[model samples]
Target: MSLKYAPKYRVFLFLIFCIIKACDVLFIAYMIKLMLNLASSGSKDVTELIKLATIAGIGQLFFTCSNFFYEHLKMTIIKNVNLVLKNANLNYLVAQAKNDTKSGLSLMTNDLKQIETGRVTAQLDMCYQSILFIGAISFAFINSWQMTVIFIVASIAPALVQILTSRLITRKAKVWANANADYTQHVSDSLNGAEAAKLYNVQPTIISRAVNSAQRMEEALRSMNFTQAWALEVIYTVAELFCFIIPCTIGGVLMMHGQLKVGTLVLMVDLAMNFITPVVTIFQEFNQVKSTDPMWKKTLRALNYSKNPHEKAIDQRDDFIDLKIDNLAYKTNKTNTEIFKDVNFSVTPGKKTLLMAPSGWGKTTLLKLMMGSKSPSKGQILINDQNLTNDWSKLHNYFSYVNQKPFMFDDTLRFNITLGRKVSDQKLRQVIHEAGLDELVKEKGLDSPIGENGNQLSGGQIQRVEIARALLSHRPILLADEATSALDPHLSLEIHETLLKNPNIAVIEVAHKISPAEKAMFDQIIHLNQTPTD
Candidate 1:
């Protein structure tokens, strides 16, 4: 998945950098051997030594420059890959039947970080280390194949250690990822309920709950970190003990028998360290990369999500048509408890319909069903006498929803209304005027920033902003679920008037309580007394 998102040219540059880095190391090692041999000679050549030192200095400088670009390119690719994955996952979550907000948040933060560090960076490091190891071992073999073979066979000990412990490390990482997500959810809940906690004087209880979650998350993280560290340490100890002792012992014996020169023996030892170290690093990097498989798999699912089978390519319609709900029913999947049954409703252009039901009734749920966020157990929603499938893609062009507590982005008032669309100023002002937002625009210019969730605006003003947004979309049908429930009677009446005065759009609002004056504003008031079927 990361490869799918990374730019191919950048990856190619990364490989080129790795090769340059390895060549630099080998060139410097060879230079050291030449200079040492010159110093030990009975009659040293001063000019040859100067040339060797100068070449090694040039190689080191080149390596430094390559290292800088290598790090930069590696991080750039990781950042781009993570951003794409996050956006894809967000879209997938929005398209899901039910929002799993906790998991979504977790995926964006902890899981993505894990994947970036473990899979992406580890993969890049493994490639570089493997290349370095190959170059170093080939150089060592050219110097002395017997010692090189001994070191190669001994390097297997560390690889075996990594293979044995890889599974446990992966399991620990998954546990930590889950615990981190739960902790994030707990923190979000605590912050969102801050006002309620203060009103109820239960801040201590909230703190205690958050602390418990944090402790569990930390424990899991500690276990995961410790397991990974232990495996690497064991691999390191084994690789060093075998690669160093066995090779050095054999090289010393060969030099004593006049089969190898002291200069070449020293060069082989230096090269042997390079070869053995990369072998250990490669195994360690591979283990770390394997630990992120769980997160990578989750990301793949999001990127590979398929469009709804019933989805249509149509985006907008130029005409309005009647919407009908016939014999509608719904039930909970877990409890198998019926919410409502045998419900019926209809709305046509220029109509203002009020669906009045008790507080415990499924009024909000019904609105969700109409908005295509929720599906009914048995029924059909029709537009222009055609079946309306429970898919947002099929419904968004025709229906605009106004929630009781509508969401607001922290941006300029214009963005909150047009949502980054290229709407004309004249048309925006018209919708603003129609939604009773003339005073707001005049007071705080069109570009005035609205704080997070519209905290800068009053409840009535926020409701009006949502109305303004819906009106601007030109969607013919507005399904408002208790849109004015939080406002005072006067404000509620004002909002209802703004909603119902538009003859070009139809309004179907659901609520439990309404002032008679407000109720009179609607063209039709329907009472819902739905019950479960046997």
Candidate 2:
């Protein structure tokens, strides 16, 4: 899977390296055979040995140089392939409307590691081993065809072992991959909930669950490793019995009968081992590559998803005349129960509307649908009298969202507020003032770092930063979902005033609880139960 992403020229270069390696092996074997022949001939001159040693030394040097380039090319290809895969994985996660960080982490880390070793490296090894096997067999056949035939016949056992265990190895690999992902999720959950667990005195429960997940993960890994090892062991045992012992015994008998020269018999035995080793190795590599089927399929799916049409250019606008929902409805897939039914609403430029609904009435869900983070089960959302598509990339452009918990990356305040967009300092300052974030800017400056999820800022200040983001975006509609619920009364009123005072921006805030005075600031208020308030 990853090999396809490797540069074509680099792959060609690597294949050339494999051929050179095979040639080097054959040359070394030939040198050894010549040395054995010299010894068998009862040569007395030390000069001939010296000459052979000099020639073999030069060959060894050339082989070492070829090996260095070979290893360098292998790593280069692996690096290039991994880069492509990681980028595709990142784009896929970012393109999602609601991404699971834990799942993404698992994919990028655990699954990717498996694909690297089991699929990419294994495939490359098979190529190298196959070429080397061909060269060795050719050498052996040149020396003694009868010995080569015996070696080939005996090699069938290793191939059979690989075929029989391929499915079992793949199953084990898949189980290990799944268990690894589960363990990652559990560890993340345990850490994220550590504070709550401590407060509730449930540390023991959390520890127990984490331990159980870890144990399961290790057990799966053990199973996978043991299966792979056992397969290799069987292959090795078969190779030793059939290719090594049988061929060496037959070569000795042939030599005793003078059917083969002493030097030739020794060379055939060495060549037999050479070809046999590659046969076993190729089978091992094939099984390893097969084990990554599940992970490779998952990676391919993500790559395809990242290249989806929806990920292409989408509509971007700074203003909308009106946003309306007509007979908007949503229901749960599991229970077929409506979270909200026949919901109707509309917003025009500069109009401030408050949406009131009791808890469990799907106010947040309705906001999600309007913001395009979720799709409606029925009806359509119209913008400027044109129906909107289900594509969030296009639908989300006309609105800015401020929910109860605004997400923030670990970055500078400026980047967090503007989201890495190129914004003029003048415009930035104006929005910061409008959002009542002037005090924070005055104290910390825009370049100050905001910790992850804005933990560096107070609840009220984080809400103000969210407002600053919304205002800076110049999005016409502000969809605030319990945006001030986390703040105190004073800060809530202040946030509400800042949100409502923007005459050019329409505001649609949904909340079940708000001070009456704060609620009265809206130009119009509508209840989810079809009630209206002045």
lDDT, each prediction: 0.85, 0.85
Where does model 1 exceed 4 Å of error? 40-43, 97-99, 306-317, 530-534
Model 2 has a clash total of 0
Error of 2 at 270 (Å): 2.7
**What are the per-residue Cα lDDT tens digits for candidate 1 across 1-534?**
375588889888888988888887788778888888777775468888898889888888888988999889888988878788888888787777455668888888888888888888888888788888989989888878888898899888888898999999989988988898889999989998999999999999998898899999999999988999999999988888888887788888988998987778888888888888988888888778878888888888999997777776445466666989899988877787888888888888879999988887888888878877788898988888888757667766687878789888999999999998998889998999999998999999889998988889999888988998898888888888988888888999988889988887899999989999989989999999744233
Of the candidates shown, which would achieve the greatest lDDT relative to the real structure?
1
Error of 1 at 163 (Å): 0.9
How does each model score on TM-score?
A: 0.93, 0.93
TM-score of 1: 0.93
In model 2, pairs of residues that clash are: none
What is the alpha-carbon lDDT for the whole of candidate 1?
A: 0.85
